[model samples]
Target: MSKAVIEFTDFSFTYRAQQEPTLRGINLSIREGEKVLIVGPSGSGKSTLAHCINGLIPFYYPGETAGSLRIMGQEQQEQSIAALSQTVGTVLQDPDGQFVGLTVGEDIAFVLENAAVPLQEMKERVTAAARAAGIGDLLSASPQELSGGQKQKTMLAGVLAGNVDILLFDEPLASLDPFTGTRTIEHIDRLQRETGKTVIIIEHRLEEVLHRPVDRIIIMNDGVIACDLPPAELLSSGLLAGTGLREPLYLTALRYAGVAVTPDLQPQHPELIRLEGAAQRLEQWVDGYREQSGPAEAVPLLELKEVTFGYERETAVLDKLSLTVNRGEMLAIAGRNGAGKSTVSKLICGFYKPSSGSIWLNGRDIGRDTIKERAERIGFVMQNPNHMLSKTLLYDEVAFGLKLRDVPEELIRERVHGVLRICGLHAFREWPISALSYGQKKRVTIASILVLEPEIIILDEPTAGQDYRHYNEMMEFLRGLSSRGITVIMITHDMHLMLEYAQRAIVLADGKKAGDDRPERILTDRSIVEKANLRETSLYTLALRAGLQQPEELVRTFIAFDREVRRR
Candidate 1:
């Protein structure tokens, strides 16, 4: 048996700025060469635990520590941050914040350069790390110029070059497409196997992280360890259902089909699991399922005609793209990173003008509208809340837009309070923005826009980095907005979110529309899914493995059933 490299006994931590303890009475051990996943809802103390391990708990985030904690059998308080960093290397959630060097190679070699390693040795180590990370060709490219996935790879190579025994990834899949997330998990698995290093991943996307094998999963809830077990055991125990973490889609499908999931069946991998009579049960469920009526014929509210745009004169980001969005519709814009998903949203918001075409809104040309003018009718919420929030208090932040419009003080107060309640932020109205979690901050930004009461709202990756409960809450709120005749456009890479919430999906690839259809159809179509860097959901894989003749139909039926269940 491998020795425990990380151990905690009766551990607890309280930040200097907080009154209550963030991590409480935690007892845990992680063995060397083990790959483990830690997950929980926001403010569940998972991040605090990670900070403790990476020497940031006391060194960076000044905090009070209690009980005992050890790294590699040595007391944690005895080591400096720089010394702990040599043994533990972390890849942050936002890779952009970690970049220091101009080029990929320089970034990877930054640590070695600081250590005064020989020039030849640094080059050899950097090259080897880049090749291992599958970014050898990008050595000369600027880190800022790379795609989301490429930036993550560069961060991984930089950590790998440090030759740390333990690797930690913080929300590694938050910014990646479904296909790229799977590939990243595969790469992490390969590295752990080849190097015999301990791996720890802290993420909310449970399904994506389970793509590769894991030794165990640790569930954190309210400043304590809730459960710790192996993958198969944990899935079979049904503990995840109440923890606000989503089970793998295929496993959920099995339950929906009346199949009892057991550990002996190996529930971790859908393709390998054995489900006796599952096919017949699923078929019966589908046969008994009645399809809901489609929406009334769409009334075009916004249209783009042969729009062409390019950041550089020689290279086009969007090429003669044309599409129409219906009034009171919920639309999903999806594609791989750097595939012009956000560019389309920007063009609609009047941030950039098309080079050769026009945009029409409600039968009127919007080509000459200023960005401020467009903001009155079209609201855009960025992926990062930090970029949008300016006020210190939550109430002030939400009221900023209304105040800017010279609304009466009484009217602004009523509108701000109403929007806050809808966003589930009324309780924290007077709290400082810095005290809120990442998910809560995101809601504040949305509330700021909701006060404006725009006709159409565009959210870029709204559910990214959020737990299952928070994700459901946000989508349900958006669904309510759509029911009231508000149009919503979400730029996303989450296939499951697209399947669950999006009424129509527009797929972009190489600056052109690749497919426009219902989310289930878009996800199941092999050619379109592959071309747009999306993988078929595991539910589809379950159908194919069961030899179902109509896999797409099964996917559609399952989505309908899942939505109905959630509605209750």
Candidate 2:
């Protein structure tokens, strides 16, 4: 029998500023050596539950709490956060915020130093943790200079150095690419097995987290536990889609092809999931598939001609790259980390100047234009929403740009409210920015940029950590913008978003143009997908398993089917 590591009994919590409770009557228990996933839509109290476990509810956020809660067989209320830290080590969404030392080795040893360990013991613990995380070579490197995956490993090393038995990961894969995300999950799984730690992962990306086997999935909605079941049972129940959360893409594809999920199937590892008559159903679907008409002739809105740029003189981030964004088109720029995806956006926004080539907006060259001047025509929404938001209130932030342009007061109100409604921030217009969640703050940033009415919008992973509902709403809003003649260029690592919404996609590999074509073509090409480190959608795999000659064609049919389902 396993020992219970966390227990909650009829617990409820409410913020001081709000009238309604965020979490109510929650009862849960997690045992040692168990790996569990917690998923929910936005504003679903998932974070609130995590906060309660980490002692952030009453201590940091100052919320009203009731009922019994225990961690490691001790009453939560009786333990201080400092005391809880010894048992529960949390890896936050942003690893940069958790670092305390300049170098990787120093950061991992910082926890040991606080415990008054001897110098030799501290070094020993740091070395062991770094080796366990497979980041021993990065010990001398600066933490801030590491890549997203390396930074995450460093954070994990710090937690391991503390000798914690309970590990909590809060959206650990949100900032990583698909390849890196897969490796990170593997590392976490290895640590859990070797140390027998209770692993709880709070994430919106359910598929990636399930790369390893999870004992259970706990679905929360409206402050209540909606479903708690083992992975196989949960997938078979079909409750994931009903809860407004995304079911795994492979499972979704199987359902669309008329294949039922089996009781013993694993959704995360698609190769292992087997359904009776799956091949026949997929073959039939492909036989009846019809391709939609291609996109109409596009008029160029933004043009890059032989662009070459590099931070240093000898190294070029983007070398002799040429591309075009058509008016009213949605283009996705995709690649692994350091593939010049964001560099392309930076050049368009005037953050970096191209060394050899020129950039043109409409017909005029804008290579030498200032960022402020380019801001009028091109709006860039960064990955971190907090970096873009300046105003205290949501409404003020959305309206600030128009006010600066000296627009009429009446027109400003009209534009601000309109953009807020489109971005789904109209309801939170009066709320303070600090009171809003990270996802809500991201919407505010998009609204702030949208109210400027720029001809071209460049969003850097706009849906990076967003829930399904928010992602759908935001993508629909961007689609609406494209219909109204606004060019939208999305720099993202999300394969689903790229395949579904982007009519045209540009694949970047080693700072060069790898493939520029329809998203379907770019993803189906083995060389381009592998070189760019992008994952092919499960639809393609299902096509191959169904023995179809043209897998890409069948994949396009799945995309069409999904688009039609959303329309309904």
Candidate 3:
């Protein structure tokens, strides 16, 4: 038997701010050299459990934690998160949140420096860690300049530099592009192969790690271990439904469709349910499309003409890319990290002047106006709310743009308050911006831009750090704006969002257009999904893999079939 690296015995914890304990009745043992994936919905005590592993529960969080958590055979309370660092290295959900150094090289060195390694040996360790994390080429670059994936890998490299016995990652892929996120997990898999260190990852997207060999799958709910089993038996036990976690999308789709799992079938081994329920549900959703005769408006609101953009040497992030956006169109740009997807958004918003090509907004050359003019015409909400936030209070922050435009107090009040309600921030109107959680703050930043009431609104990664319920609310709100005749262009890594919300998807690869098609078309295209490193919706994957080759048609069928099932 392998040695137990960490163990929790009947542990439960309550955060300082909450009346109820976030986690309750948790019991588990982790083995050295083992890789385990922990999953649960948001606020399910998964994070709390992870914090306990490294003693963050009491040290960083002044909370009441009952029961016992042991790290390296020492009680968790005895070891500070700092002291526990030698035994276990932890990376947070956000890479930027954990970054300690301004430059990549300096960050890696800092981890080793704390280990009190010799300067010569430290350099060797840093180099090896950086190489292992695949950030060697970016050693000298500013940490801020690296893409989301690169930033994460840099942090991973820092974690590995200490050469700890156990590594803990908290939703490491939360902020990364799907492609980069998958690659990051793959890199971690490689590290496990080479170093033989125990790894515990807290992840939301199960599909990314599903194919990777893991020692155990631990599901958490209401702060306790709901199920602990090998992958083969995990699903058949009805554990997923009880926990309310989305199973592998494909599996969920199949289960909903009423397909039976055979005795010989292995749940963990890429098994697909036969397409009975799937085809029914899929066809229903597809048939709804026929109900829509045309776009909400008649004329194109934004048009791109042979857009070619890049640095010297004729490099094109947007290679002769041409696209049309009608009033009320919500167009999502998607591709692998570092693909020219964001470049096209920057070009449209006037963040970058295209090397060649012209952009027309409302039948006028957008090139004719300055960025400020472009801002007035189109509002850009960046991925990070902190990046866009400027004011102390939530109300002021939302009103800043309108006030700058010299709008009157009466108008601003009506606009700002209305935005606050829609964005779900009216209650916190007087609170400091710093007081808001990450998701609320993001919505606030978006509300600020929305108040500007630009004809065109562009949001990058709008759904990051959001729950499914909030995701629905935000999209429903965006759909309302589209109904009011605003053009929305989104740059996103969320395939589900692209699948359900977006009317059109523009894919980029190597600084050029890969495909410009309806999202349903793009979502199921095996080549595009592979090349773009897109997360195929479980629904679509199950339908296709289950002998229902046509996903769009299946989606249509499923909607109708689901309603019928509900009705019966």
> Could you tally the backbone clashes for each prediction?
0, 0, 24
Which candidate number has the best lDDT? 1
CA RMSD for every model? 1.3, 1.5, 4.3
Candidate 1 vs candidate 3, TM-score winner: 1
Q: What's the distance in Å from true for residue 122, model 3?
A: 2.5
Q: In angstroms, how far off is 154's CA in candidate 1?
A: 0.8
Position 19, candidate 3: lDDT:
82
Candidate 2 accuracy as lDDT: 0.88
How do these models rank on TM-score, best leading?
A: 1, 2, 3
Question: What is the lDDT, from 0 to 100, of the residue 501 in candidate 1?
Answer: 89
Task: List TM-scores for all candidates, in order.
Answer: 0.98, 0.97, 0.82
Against the reference, the lDDT scores of all candidates come to 0.91, 0.88, 0.77
State, as a TM-score between 0 and 1, how close model 1 is to the true structure.
0.98
Candidate 2 matches the true fold with a TM-score of 0.97
User: After aligning candidate 1 to the native by TM-score, how far in Å is the CA of 257 from where it should be?
Assistant: 1.8
